[model samples]
Target: MAVSLKRTPLYQEHLSLGARMVPFAGWEMPLQYTGIIEEHHAVRREAGLFDISHMARIFVTGPAAFDLLQRTVTRDLSRVEIGQSAYALACNEEGGILDDLYVYHSGPEEYVVIGNAANRDRDFGWLAAQKRAGEPVEVIDRSDELGMVAFQGPKAPALLQSIVETDILSIPRHGCGYVDILGYRCFIGRTGYTGEDGFEVLVPVEGAVALWRRILNLDVRPCGLGARDTLRLEAALMLYGNDIDLTTNPYEAGLGWVVNLDKGPFIGRDVLAAIKARGASRRLVCFEMFERGDIARPGYPIYHDGREVGRVTSGGPSPTLGKNIGMGYVPVDLAVVGTRLDIKIRDRFGPAQVVRRPFYRSPSLGG
Candidate 1:
């Protein structure tokens, strides 16, 4: 039997907009509305709205909620204050990344953990299992009742400010606050995956359609997963299953900044500390194709001096850069900028050079 896919509250809205639907992470989501390249450029030049309710929103509350997060995730959540959010990774005991998520400190004893759709159940189970026999933490899966929408771009704030009563610009990067949108209570976070100034709004499921339609009235481009993937790749952001997974560690995936070895103790502290001391053998690097005919893709073999060194994790053509760019794991010695490598695409090898991560950066956001 074919497993039935789930749908967000905005499913009908997507259909009404003539979206091309496809199965992604057990959900029937819009792959594109207008077109991939057109939607991608819209977000880069103006503002684009995305239905991201497919992402999991798990709430952790109680007196021990902070303690629960401090032990499970790699980042030190104790330092996060109310209205602040941080990107973190949940790792297993062996220091392998399970999933990368965002934790928002909603209040003194409340936190909202936003995780990938594919890892929702696994992420919740991991946190629930880590609770001691009498721990006070309560892990609740509120994803079904909540709806998430990401409005991203350089003009995102201006667009959002016109809709909400609160001043959108007052919220700093990685900060979050509650505001009223069209008479509905919504939580807006100044965070996004596209490396642009934006907000991820969480509203009740019943209010999703209304909010989406209101944003649409502002002439915001409605983006889909196809454009989201390309935008994040251009920003060099890691996809959970693609760039980082059980076989990859944070240090090796170029996510060392999120790992706090000095913080008391966490699940992967010991192994991560050891890796930090010895250094990673292989490092993730971003590369741009020197030749234009072929585009690099995931699972393609990477070679240095005719020796198979690693494999591509994420690869595709960047809409903003108008060139083929990719990220792959390569030997530490060959991961430096300006290093030349060959990517085996099908029958032929293509010339590529390692460049800085975040292949594209918005001038408005600054370096």
Candidate 2:
């Protein structure tokens, strides 16, 4: 018999809000409410709330935690200061990506690593193995105890300020602070997947429903995974499983900035160094359809001079731009801006042009 999936604390609340739920990485997750386009626009214009509880939250703490983690991830954890977060990647000895995650330095020797839901088990096991190797790290899977909610958009600060005691307007991007939400102590981070100003609040699982309701009562629209995907895509953020994976490195995915080659030896340092010398064979590029009513999607063949050159990885109707935009990998020579190409949509080739990444620029949240 098939096993039942787990539900977040806000499962019932999502249902009550008329969310269209779907199975995501072994969890019952909301796909959309009031349609993907509406929810996507809500987070871009106003503010939208997301139940991101399905993401795994694990903590690594101990005297040797810093040293142990330094050997496992691509980023130089030594650079991350307390109350700050950084994007990191886990890699195998051969330099293949094991997973991409966000690492938060909660204290001097304590850290929180948020891994993708689909790679939680593998990531946990890998960290456990490193700890067993006598690395002074004690890994704890806090995924069950912690829940996360993302509030994003232009009005995010305003909505959150009304709920929290501290003035959120002062917190810098990538900064975090502790706040009490209705008797529950939560960690609020000024980070989000969408190209919008936002905060991701981590709270106790039991308090997730109450917090969700409170945000809803404040008129923050409930957004689902569908909108979340489109928003991130429009922002040119790479999705782990789709836009990037083990086969793709940070340099090819347009994330080379996150890798500090100048930093000392890292898990993928040698391999990345070699790649840097050789140069990437292919590059990720963004493109837009020329005419209206044309919808492009992943796996669609891209053509140049009537020959197949590459394929789209992520594409859709961008709610923020009100046009069809997409990301794909193509020959490095053909990845320049304004390069012309044709995208195969429904067996018909449509004209498109290569454009810059970050299809949308968010308004400044700092006052």
Candidate 3:
């Protein structure tokens, strides 16, 4: 039987705005509100709001929270103090990533784990297994109780300051605070996926629509998944379902920097260490077409020396760069800057070259 997809509290508002809705990860989501480029620019130049309530939120609160998390995720949870967040991956025994997530230390013995919407069931099951094996943390799936809102762009801080009572301007990047909004305590984190300064707010689902209206009333345009996709692509941030999956390890996916083998024992530690020792064969790199015509896309063949070498994993037209940019796996020899190659787009191939990660850089983040 086909299960009915869920909708966020802002679904009616999206309809009122004539947003193009589509199914994404089993949710009736907004594909675009205004035009993709317009929404993209809104988030890049000013503030834009996103309804990311569909994303999974799990809480771990217990005396052994730190140690239990330490034994599970790739990053060391011990180093993350309260009010800070760290991005890490949950991997299986063989070093294959189950899902990539952010760990937010909410208190001394409390932490919230955020995961992709599609991986909620699988991730929860894995965490349950770990608990059964004597891992001392209590994992509670609180996905239904929370509503997540992302206010992003250059004007994000100012807009956020006007809504919530807290002084967000004083909060540094990656810093989080608790604020009262609509008579409820909200966990607000100054972090986002777009290559811009922003805040992600976790609030009670009951006040979600009111909060959404509050943001929209503040002149922050509503952005959809279409604009979100293009923005993240321009930033060269990896998407879980598109860029990497269960088979791809951090070493091969150009995310090796996030892996800390010296942080101590964790699942997939030995496998990652071995892969690091031997070095990776294929490396992920960003590239652009030399000419203007072809649109590079994922699964497109990459050619070097007239031979099939690699394949594109994520590609799209970047609104910020005003050009087609893509990321893919290529032989280590050809993954350097200025390495010329070709991208097979349908019946023809176009001139392309390998560049560096982050096709576009953010001056604020020192990218």
Candidates in order, TM-scores: namely: 0.98, 0.95, 0.97
Query: What value of lDDT does candidate 1 attain over all alpha carbons?
Result: 0.93
Residue lDDT tens for model 1, 1-367:
8889999999999999999999999999999998999999988999999999999899999999999999899998878999999999999989999999999998778899999999999998998888888988899999999899999998988999998776778889999978899998888899999878889999999999999999989999899999999999999999999999999999999999999888888998999999999999999999999877879999999999998999999999998998999999999999899999999999999999999987988864774
Best model per lDDT: 1
Clashing pairs in 2: none
Instruction: Give the alpha carbon lDDT tens digit for every residue of 1-367 in model 2.
Output: 7968889888988898888999999999999988999999899889999999988788899888787787778888888888888888887766567888888887778888888998999899888788756666799999989889999998988888898886777877888767898889998888889888989999998888888889888988999999999999988887878788888877777777777777777677889888878888889899999977777899999999899999899999888788999989899999999999899998699999999887888874432
TM-score of 1: 0.98
Which model, 1 or 3, shows the larger TM-score?
1
**Model 3 clash tally, residue pairs:** 0
Q: All models: lDDT?
A: 0.93, 0.86, 0.86
Residue pairs in collision within model 3: none
Candidate 3, residues 1-367, lDDT tens digits: the string is 8979899878998999999999999999999988899999898888899999998898888888887678788887777899899889998888888899888998878888889999998888776666646656798998899899899998888878876675778888888767898777898888888888889999998988889988898878999999888888888888897788888888888888778889999888999899889998888889988766778988999999899998899887887887888999888888899999899999998988887778887665666
- Candidate 3 at residue 117, lDDT? 93
Clashes of each: 0, 0, 0
- What's the residue-level lDDT of 217 in candidate 2? 89
